[model samples]
Target: MQGTLKDAREVAVKKLSRGLSQGAKVFMNKAMLLSCVQHKNVVNLHGYCTASICQKGGQRMLWTP
Candidate 1:
């Protein structure tokens, strides 16, 4: 998905596939990879995050903010 931040900077956002996602641990890995690559003409990566919710009875809820 694409969006514009409050600063008016355009960005492209990739939604992690819930079926294949691995929460924050993996998210940080991907972000690290993105941060390591550099190119004069390529866009720079900002960061990433993982959000989740746990309910009573040990139910797990996953979501993105």
Candidate 2:
């Protein structure tokens, strides 16, 4: 999924391609990136969710502020 930030809020939603590698790397990468940035130009990262496999048959991650 694709989204744009508004009013100091940021959101990122990832729709994983099927048969992709299952590893902690994806989450780790997002966590690392979110930890480093804190600025007005950068909308704050609020939270995230890992989608159920039955829905899309692949993980979907969503982050918001």
Candidate 3:
């Protein structure tokens, strides 16, 4: 999805599927790369989040974002 920051800069937000091991691995790899790795074509990653909300059943996600 698209979003606008406080500075009025437009940006993209990506939330990958929750059920795949490959997706989780990709998320970790992206998170590991700091903004210092600069390139004209590569966009900088702003942030990410992972949450596990409890439920009566075993609905908790053991890992991944």
| Candidate 1 collision pairs | none
Question: Lowest lDDT 10-mer window, candidate 2?
Answer: 15-24
**Model 2 misses residue 49 by how many Å?**
2.2
Cα lDDT of model 2 by residue, 8-44, tens digit = 5545655444344634477657655865779878765
Q: Which ranges in model 2 have alpha carbons more than 4 Å from their true place?
A: 1-23, 51-56
lDDT of 3 by residue, 1-65 (tens): 67666677666765455555536566557566633456777776665544443211322222111
**Stretches of candidate 3 exceeding 4 Å from the true structure:** 5-9, 22-26, 34-36, 53-65
Clashing pairs in 2: none
Cα displacement (angstroms), candidate 3, residue 39, comes to 1.0
Best by TM-score: 1
The count of backbone overlaps in candidate 2 is 0
Q: 1 or 2: which has the higher TM-score?
A: 1
Arrange candidates, best lDDT first: 2, 1, 3
In terms of lDDT, the best-performing candidate is 2
In candidate 2, residue 60 scores what lDDT? Answer: 45
lDDT per residue for candidate 1 within 3-59, as digits (tens), equals 566677666766555444644566668667777768877566764445343222322
Error of 2 at 15 (Å): 4.2
